[model samples]
Target chain A: MKILFLGFGNVARRLAAIVTDEGWPSRRGTFPVEVVGLFTASRGSLAGAVDLARARAELEATGRFDARHPLRTDMTPLEASRNLDYDVLVELSPLAIEARGEPAVSHIASALARGRHVVTANKGPVAFAYRKLAALAETQGVRFLFESSVMDGAPLFNMARVALRGCRVEAFAGILNGTTNAILCHMERGGSLEEGIAAAQAAGIAEADPSHDVDGWDGAAKTAALANVLMEADVTPFDVERRGIGSVSVGEVRRALAAGRRLKLVCRACRREGAIQTSVAVEEVAADDPFSLVDAYGAILRIETDLMHPLVLTQEGPEVMDTAYGVLNDLMEIAGTAERKGEEP
Target chain B: MKILFLGFGNVARRLAAIVTDEGWPSRRGTFPVEVVGLFTASRGSLAGAVDLARARAELEATGRFDARHPLRTDMTPLEASRNLDYDVLVELSPLAIEARGEPAVSHIASALARGRHVVTANKGPVAFAYRKLAALAETQGVRFLFESSVMDGAPLFNMARVALRGCRVEAFAGILNGTTNAILCHMERGGSLEEGIAAAQAAGIAEADPSHDVDGWDGAAKTAALANVLMEADVTPFDVERRGIGSVSVGEVRRALAAGRRLKLVCRACRREGAIQTSVAVEEVAADDPFSLVDAYGAILRIETDLMHPLVLTQEGPEVMDTAYGVLNDLMEIAGTAERKGEEP
Candidate 1:
């Protein structure tokens, strides 16, 4: 499969390295994936089939990918997505949630319009334009999969879509943001809020700005996206009652710990009175709740379904590889090369 | 699709009801499932295209289904599975761990040899002969899906197969048995061991014998089945290092609770030195472990992968509906009527 990458960020670079690394044992053996195009905001864009391994290595060694390096082109991601020959588009651009899923949404929309399959790690497009882009993908008989958007590709949407058959997702409550949760974990350990944020940044888990991680926007976006896709609700981040970890203090964390509870930024979406009500709030969860057990860099989601009363799922280490695997997982599904029965390799 | 049912037990009866009940909202709309046959050890047998709705109602009311009933027939389930015109077989017989997955194994083997797809709630066939049956089904282009075996269809195998694509399973530890867990939960609540057993029986969660659950055979069988399917181990129940909840004392439970811990029957499987090692043992888990949060009639599975550190999953209410939905979920995947993009009902 010929692939086009919209952004050469950490996640996309890892994906390319994994796909090109012969040492990396793939579930689907030696799947034919070639990097045909790459476009980044600051880094120059390139088109035409290129050595993805070299591209990944160059980007990793340096900080940016130049169009003049080996694979030369002067096309933007949108232009490459329009004119380039590729089977699927990997959109890993940084989130632009403030603009209501701008350039990312437009890039994905253009790719879908041209009858191309899209795999994304950008939550912006899905957070705002899930219904529209999903409908467009269906009309075109192509998949628009973003398994990384919600829980860094820990099978959140796929679990709902494939496994929860014949059951409706009545409600869901989850700790969606890992960086903020890590910071909270630090704060719970008597560390100041600044120390927590700084620790996360030093570990390369949080962005430099850290506003999205400190504010409620990231969690709210995930909640809105989950609500729209799984809960069948047409909603956006603006619809969520948002709260962030910014208000949490060491004193409050210590108090909650003394009461055998943990304060967590939880994103909940439930159907009430026949409408989906969503919120991202800081709640004091009991010691027995799964959230209390979620450690730093870990996330847990509890889903209430019609058949199964409640299902809780937790994953640790929302690293760049998780997001990279999401793109590969979605690509396998789109390529119809998903693992089959009786094939253990 | 014409479906032949072997055994009219709680899980099978619930499956038939959910499939035939017009009022039951299905993820796949009005799925084309025709009951071609049903055979029970004591409830009798039927053949030919049966009115599944009326069949379900009769079984629910009478607790037995006779050939002379409304859906009259003369053929047994095995004979129907071999000779009748059917596309799929639903196996829901009682567990026969001591017999090493008896009659169920033969029944499923016969159906698979006949090129019929099989969906089973019975753990026997999978526990004993997963590689053999899976190979046969693959060679015949038929699916032998037994989602209900491990976690009563909480997506254990499906999650690993369908979602965790590029990663490899290094180890997994989980509380797989529900009835024994329920009994342990009762014991933790100051109930006597006998009372806990009695409560589980009264709730229909445990069999009248209750030995399979409390004796550790059930968890061992599940561990063996999961090891066979997921970890690719050719082992059986007898091979697992087994310990039962019957050995757990109420005083010990209280002590663990006082220490912020919970006693749980944990089934662990790990690939050590290129070989899969499995055990089902009672362990005292910390309050922070997800297993500590798993209530009576609830389950928690923690999977350690090479990519993701550990993925923890918990589910509550292991009722008849969960097992029934497992059959339906497998059937959907087999019939390829699974949810498509923008085609949700």
Candidate 2:
């Protein structure tokens, strides 16, 4: 399998190192993956079968590329995706949630147009243009899998596809954003929101610019993506009734906790009269509710299905490696599908 | 898809009624299923495309069956499996944990030898001869799926296969038996074990003879099945270090509860020193542990994997319908495979 990575930031770099270390395809009987292209906005791009190990080393030694490295080019992700030779494209660009999924969307569209499968952790492309991208992938005979778009690789989409086979999901609620949840948890325990955000940022769980996390854009994007995937609703993040944890005061958090409730940034999507309705807001969850018990770094998705009633899937901790594993998961699934059809993986 | 029910017990009967009501193959775009045969230990056997609705009605009217029912004969499951024609055989016989999976093991072998796919709720066949039966099914080009053998329809095996993907599971701990967990939870709350058992029986959660559940045989069987499926171990119920909730005293439960810990019947299987070591026993779990929060009727499976860390799967309220749904889930999966292969389902 020939692969290319777009936006070689922390996620892409980690994924590349793991792929290189595990000898790509990792001896688990899947087809060997050869990274054919590497692209980034500022760190330079490489085309035509770049050395992944050397690229990873260069990134580790310095913030960007070692200029002397072979195959380094001044190309962007969109340009490389259009001109490069690859079978699968991994999109790891920073999410442009409010910009209607710009560079990542274009990168994905270009790859799909060229008959290549796309695996991504970027939420913008899915939250903004899921239907069109999905249609294009289906039309082009490729897979557009984004298991990390929601809940940081907890296998939510795969759960809907494989585990909940033939069962209809009536509703779903989750703590989609780890940063905001952490802040709220801290506030509930007598810390200020700023204190919690700083703690999370210092721990590398939150980004420097905490606007998206605090404003609930991350949760809204995830909710929209899930609504699109599970409920087949052509909804975007903008369509969701978005409310962030910023409005949740420390006093309110303390009051809720005293009243046997925990204030949480809950992302909920439910099917009402055959249409999907979604919201991302601060809700008071009872002490017994599973959502109330999830830690700041952990996530939990409660899906109400026709056959299984309410099925709870919880992840103990979320990490960057978890997001990278989601991409690998999608790749393995694509390979498994090919293998099932008796195709060379 | 022609399905044969080997044992017309609660699970089988519920499945048949659902199939009849929903007109089997219930939407999700798989092949339509027709119940071809129905056999029971004492209720007699019906051969050659049994009318599911009529059979359901007959079973509902009489606890067993009426002699006047058409095509009824005094035939055992093994005999029916051999003589009757079926595409899939559902092994819903009474679990013989102490018998080393007697009738179920033989019956499964008979069906697989005849090139019929097998879906079973009985844990015995898997606990005793999982590798052999799996090999037989693979050799015969059929699937031997037993999702209900562990945690009813909680998606344990499916989670391992689909969600875990190439990720290796290092260890797994679960409350596999609902009845014992219920008893333990009740004991923690100052109720007697007998009282808990009686309440469970009243709620149709326990069998009339609760020896199998209270003796830890059920948990041991499930542990062996999981060890076989997840670790690929050739182990049986006899191999596990088994201790039931019967020996747990009320004082012990109270003391644990007072110490911010809950006593649970935890079934653990782990890869220790390159060998699978498993045990089913009453253990004291901390209040913060997810396993401690699961209710008596609810079961929780915490799997430690290479990539996903400790992934927790909790199913609230294991019921007869839940087990029936597991059988349906497996059937749908088989049909999905056939559909993908473009075969007549």
TM-score of chain A considered alone, across all candidate predictions: 0.94, 0.95
Estimate, for each residue in B1-345, the C-alpha lDDT of model 1 and write its tens digit.
788888878788777777767765445434677777878787768777788777778878888776567566667666777788778888888789878898788888899999888999888888788999999998987789998888887887777777876677788898988888888889889998899999989987888999899989989888889889877799988899998988789999999999988899999999989989999989999876678888888888888876565788887767888888877888887766323322221
Reference-based TM-score, model 2: 0.96
Candidate 1 segments exceeding 4 Å error: A66-68, A337-345, B24-26, B337-345
Clashing pairs in 1: none
lDDT of 1 at A199: 99
TM-scores for every candidate against the unseen true structure: 0.95, 0.96
Model 2 lDDT per residue over B55-124, tens place: 8888888766677766777777788889787888988987897678997899999999999899998889
- Where does candidate 2 clash, by residue pair? none
**What lDDT does the true structure give each of the candidates?**
0.83, 0.84
lDDT string for model 1 (A161-261, tens) is: 77886788899999989888899989989999999999999998888999887898999899999999888889999999998988888999999999989
Give lDDT for model 1.
Answer: 0.83
Candidate 2's docking class is medium
